[model samples]
Target: MVDTLQLILPGFLLPYLDRFMQFGQELFGGAWQDILTVVWTVIKVMLIIAPLLLGVAYTTFAERKVIGWMQVRIGPNRVGPWGLIQPLADGLKLLLKEVTIPSGADKFVFLIAPVFAFTPAVLAWAVIPFSDFLVLANVNASLLFIMAVTSISVYGIILAGWSSNSKYAFLGSMRSAAQMISYEVAMGLSLVVVLMISNSLNVVDIVQAQGQGRFADMGLNFLSWNWLPLLPMFVVYLVSIFAECGRAPFDLPEGESEIVGYHVEYAGMSFAVFQLAEYSAMILGTALISLLFLGGWSSPFGFLPDSAFWLFFKMFALLVVFFWARATFPRYRYDQVMRLGWKVFIPVCLVWLLIVGCWMMSPWNIWK
Candidate 1:
């Protein structure tokens, strides 16, 4: 599909806007024909980034509103009608604010830290399969790629804290590093169970694996998904992701009472950048949950079109659960969070992995 578009685009547009198209093509790539491919890549990237940015903006607004309703109060009604434009107002305010660097801070590292954090979250989307042949890049080892990229964001936190030259920020970053490392183990192990069941590392193949099994043939498609067979691992993955992204109850890195946490020294857009990274990771995690556990873009009924709507619907549902946890749960003690990740979740994931292995080898293997 993408190749077809790439070939068709230049043939149709090059005649009308020859000079401008040639400039873009030559600037982005080596040859004129390469222009269409470059343009197509850019369009796919924009398609992913634009919706992600909008989702992040509205996620903030939705969090405030949902939490407010939970607490029996109206939220963000002053900025625009029913606070529809609250996120826009907040974004503009941040953009207009002055970015400040402390006297002793490492200027270059401090400046680049936010970009380091933000880049990985967005880049990981390249391999995600929204629907059949709809991804920007369909790598064979996509799950591995996502794990590797997501892990790099930890450096941004450490850099932000160290470059700021502040003890409180350093302590917060240390906690974040510890938290991420502990949870990441459990998270990866949980996914190992998924890979074993689906028998594929390619995300599109994994989704397709869930589409036509016995339960799906019986018109109980939802029951046929990996979430049912790997229920324990599914739960572990969900909790570990919460800790991995530093969401509420596990948000030790940004604890409000702990001297305002890691990015406390950051001001204006720099601080906002950290926030953007965090929220982007949240949304990415939501998408992974949908694809890996809830059956990516799969319709419950056979009659529905195989489109991206189902994927986004599942992602949105998971996002609501994320905000719900934030509103309902109190912050865990740093030690308790670490204990949950290392001692509890890790052991559970390991045991479940063994159980799943045995189940897969047995004559009762449902996935077979």
Candidate 2:
């Protein structure tokens, strides 16, 4: 029986054993190098996440200021210099607020859902290529990996809704799930044109492809961006992401007027987690846009090496657009939102994908 078991296991286990042994040897062979790599990774993650957390805090301040300006009112001038400390004040308030769990909620899941939502929001930024060599992880499948991670974040919303045992939260979660799923398809298809032209899944590779001069080595201009060739796809992606992020005109999930939305019952820091996740996701989306279509970190005029400045500049530009849309547009009607996603954005993206595919294969090679 022992011999038979060994013979049977050999077929199934040998490959895994070999892989494990190889991994073990690699780890042991360069222990110091591995330690340095891990330390560097930790530092990089902290650097990225720290600024993001600060950005989230300041984004709230920015939003209030922008919305206040839009409404012709002075915004947040009370706390600290020019109200710069308002986010801190708000953070303190939320921290001091009472955290109340509902009488019959699932305590464990309810407590953990916010963490789940926030984790993916932060993790998705890891693959974003800030510059040629500044990316945290230069995965071959970065585009798909980002999509997968962003898609997984919806589960956090769903879980939060279900665990809350509140009708409004459940409805909000349902709306969010449906909206995210619908927009994700359009967003993915829109990006397909980018990948088709770049012919690479690596974000850095995509940016470099755009950096190549289009005409007689006249150094690539901004017009050579995917945004120009794939204008329709670009529009679709922008709108689709607005929906995916549950931002204004697409914030059906969190309709404060009619429904309190997903975090309806959440309080204190638990509620803060949802807000943090939302802003983080917004930053992630903007970063992806910068990397995918805006020549990521590359100077549009080609006078400068691709640097952090360009990455942050492009990302901040997109972030401004996000806020401008929120301040300018009204929440979309739920049915209209769904129809736009299904009937308009998805179909347009699909047709554009076909156009891009055909363009890639054409003898003329316009994109090339």
lDDT of each: 0.88, 0.83
Candidate 1 residue 72 Cα shift, in angstroms, is 1.6
Residue clash pairs of candidate 2: none
For model 2, what is the alpha-carbon lDDT of residue 286?
Answer: 84
lDDT (tens digit, per residue) of candidate 1 on 1-368:
34464567867764656566667666867675666668778987998899899989999999899889988999889988899999999999999999999889999999999998899999999999889878889989999999999999989989998999999888888888888888899999999999998898999989999886888888777888889888989899999889888899788766776535678899899999989998999999999999999889998776677679999999888988998999899899988988898889889998998998999899988787
Tens digit of per-residue lDDT, candidate 2, span 1-368: 22333476758786785575567667787584576468667977998889889998998898888878888988999999999999999999999998778878999999999898888888888888777887889999998999888888888899899999988788889988888998898898888788888989988899888777563156556767667788898788888878888888787766788756788889999999888888888888888877777778778775656688988999888988888898899788888989999999888888888887887788967656
TM-scores of all candidate predictions against the true structure: 0.92, 0.88
In each prediction, how many residue pairs overlap at the backbone (N, C-alpha, C within less than 3 A)? 0, 0
**Model 2 TM-score relative to the real fold:** 0.88
Cα lDDT for residue 34, candidate 2:
71
List candidate 1 segments past 4 Å from native.
1-30, 258-260
